[model samples]
Target: MRVKGEIDAYEVMAVNPYKALIVPRMVSGFLITPILTLIGTFTGILGGYIITVMVQGSNAWGFMGNLFNWLDMTDILGGIIKAAFFGILVILISCYYGFHVRGGAAGVGQATNDAVVASVVSIMVMNYFLTTAFFGFNI
Candidate 1:
């Protein structure tokens, strides 16, 4: 159960008992979030293009023209911001639970379950607050 370039878990704890294991994960999240968002955005637009042009027989030029016309800079920026925050939140929650895991395999399983549930809940709750903060409630 060893991966190349990966230190043994026990060895890591031995060398730095108080070290925060989440730091690298947080850094990775920051790096990965924007790249994922860009890929997802492109894939979504491509899917729309496929549906409109290939399936529905719409002109590609008109499909793209309408798509670009309807999408605004704010929409793209807001999505990126939200993605970044969500990435950070997910990493933080997972690391918090992972770092605190105890009682062997059972504890690891419990920690994983808790991390996933907490992350999803936090993301949903935060998304609402973030959306409201970024674009004030209209009602």
Candidate 2:
């Protein structure tokens, strides 16, 4: 926890201030949230396309066509950028809570359980707030 002391939980797996800071900071980026966010984005887009095709049926082409048409380079790029931020948030929260999950075998289980719940909740909350902030009720 940076806010509290300096455990460097997953950082170095050692003890060196310089290498610890630099290495850990870099490695921390790809921890959990970012990966989950990317996964969520892929699945979310797939789900959207699937539902559009399935529900729209005869109009699926039109739907997909319009969807792709509206999504210009900026929109797509914005999505990737936003996803990266969301991923960071999710990972930070998860790592914050899960970094200290320790005890024994049972503690490991608890850590995993907490990590999953935190990750999902973090994603959902971020998704809602981000969507609202970006598009809100206008869309």
The best candidate in terms of TM-score: 1
Q: How would you encode candidate 2's per-residue C-alpha lDDT over 3-71 as one tens digit per residue?
A: 334555534566764464444643566455456655876788779878777776557778768878887
RMSD of each: 4.2, 6.1
Q: Runs in model 1 with CA error above 4 Å?
A: 1-20, 137-139
Candidate 1 global Cα RMSD: 4.2
Best by lDDT: 1
lDDT of each: 0.81, 0.64
Residue 84 displacement (Å), model 2? 0.8
Candidate 2 lDDT score relative to the true structure:
0.64
What TM-scores do the predictions have?
A: 0.81, 0.56
